[model samples]
Target: MSATVFAGALFAGPVLAGPLRANANDVPLADIPALVLPALGETLIMVGIVMAVVVVVGVPLGAIIHNLARDGLFPNPSLHSALSWIVSVGRSLPFLILMVAIIPFTRLLTGTNIGIAAAVVPMSVAGIAFFTRIVENSLRSVPPSLVKVAKSSGGSSFQIIRTAQLGEAVPSLIGGLTINTIAMIEYSAIAGTIGAGGIGYVAITYGYQRFDNQVMLATIIILVALVAAVQVIGDALVRLTTPHSSTASDRRFARKVARLDIESANAASPV
Candidate 1:
């Protein structure tokens, strides 16, 4: 069993022993990073590549799809509906199924179906589909009057999309982007079934197979922290991009406080 397990180490992560000993149940916490860091790096690289492709392809694809709607500047209902259905199909499939089903395509593109390169193809497909909708929804949220203004000023269709639609939708798009990114990170882990290197591989090998409670616990913690950090950063960017992301009541209270401060100063001054 031990030899057979080591033989399939490609699916599992590197066997840590010689200098960096990891004993799942009995290993020192310090040695866990040796096993986990490389996995984390793989996850990051996979997600990063997927997002870059999503942004490059999905953003424009979304813009094109949205602009084909009856209410859009171009207004082509047939094209819009067809594109919409296509995107819907992409989103409807579960990621795991998407990965497995697309193995042939993945192999055709990457020339191998057992590494980060193979993982990227399915992830990119799913992510592009997911984010195209996000971009569309974000663009939809833009006020119609913004489009009207752009048109009334003699803006071209492309200009309207760039300056009026996408530019105005920055905050919402960022929020959607943040959500998509976290989802892709999860997909990368699920991509582990193909022997894609990531935190998921670590969990399966060290935690699940080896019964390494400590390593499993660490993976969980790291996953949570990674997600929280993305959310925090994304929220910060959204707030920064928005003109006045604060509540109306907050603004009103601030004005009231300023007024009171002025009154108090006047009262304190001599006649």
Candidate 2:
């Protein structure tokens, strides 16, 4: 009897749930394109604004921090320590909590605690701290000999940074920016909880609240595609900027051979 009842429930489950599906207001497959496009646009806008702010502000702040540290170009330990502490604190906070914590500042900046404009403030703030660390690390990784050469040439601190440090660190910096941009996308989704509109909002409103499984699935697919695209583009840029090791080695070998030839010729002469 128990087996029979189990079989009956299993067979009846789909039939019982058919009534719920009758509601035509639920997410339909045909409407997914229209629904997803606006959210995608909004997400792009939020991330674009945040990245611009991060590049403009974070890169310089990071460069300053790196330059002021011990053995840095400027070597101001006091300023470096203070700035490092602040960046540490900012980076330590969870982004969601950071968003809520900065509501007042967001409101002050955008005059409203809701929408893409308001979301930009906290997103940019978080991005700045994160990207600053990335930039600092990238600059730090630059070959010290390059900086020494620049200094020997009577280059100013700014000139050394611009011509040697940043120029050498381009590949690493691009990689960092790629990671930061992906992180901002995640934060943007979380921002949807506070009336900031995007795919997250759609997922929450239609998928979670209305129990539209199709909408939820669609949103997931869209987000995955977006992130994948970002990573591919970032990787391509990094590859383009990075020097090919084989080519570099071949050039180094050619230079060594040329130098040996010159030394042999000079030694053979009456010098």
Candidate 3:
């Protein structure tokens, strides 16, 4: 009776082990090239599109907001107040919640709620709002006296913004852009919840659902590398644009312009 029981137990062990081996991801290492390349491409595409839209729309929107506020070149308190409120509301929402809330809008724009195109809508919207605030803050950091110098020289509002404000703020703006771009990459991953095909989607479908830890780890590593590359490039650009002597000269010029602007304002006032 003992011998017979041992034989039955030995047979059952192999049978149970067979299913566990089969359940593990086959060719997980081999599948890396096939899966990661395409998913990485999709991620880049989504982030690229969202960033393009954000730069084109958000930069101008921020500039307009900056120029319209009090102490700006052309203050319009009511308009600035309204636009500021809109931006604040946009910036306050969490990205995931924003995605769900904009489903109807996304569907309207893309005609489908489950692909890269649809994902771009919410991503771009969020990117725009976030980057606009970054740009507004960057522009505000430019010495106010720069605007005064441009005005005293008879420079138009547009010229002052283009040549004085944005020109001076380029280094800070590039830093903001780098931060915004990284944020969009994160948003792209969240977008994968809706079947937007990117590394995130791959991680979810294959890594989490199928229990493939290899794939999940690979995706994470690739994302880290990509963000690091962006940061390096962004820092390089900022360094290239900001020369020390120019920055010092700018500070000096701003101080002189500020004193002159104050004197001119005092003389022009009706006491």
Determine which window of 10 residues in candidate 3 has minimal summed lDDT. 18-27
Query: What is residue 17's positional error in candidate 2, in angstroms?
Result: 5.5
Across 43-79, the per-residue lDDT of candidate 2 in tens digits comes to 8999999999999999899999999988888899988
Listing every candidate in turn, what is its Cα RMSD in Å to the true structure after a full C-alpha superposition? 7.9, 6.8, 12.1
lDDT of 3 at 34: 95
Model 1 ranges off by over 4 Å: 1-27, 247-271
Best by TM-score: 2
**TM-score to native of every candidate shown:** 0.82, 0.83, 0.81
Q: How accurate locally is residue 174 in candidate 2, as Cα lDDT from 0 to 100?
A: 98
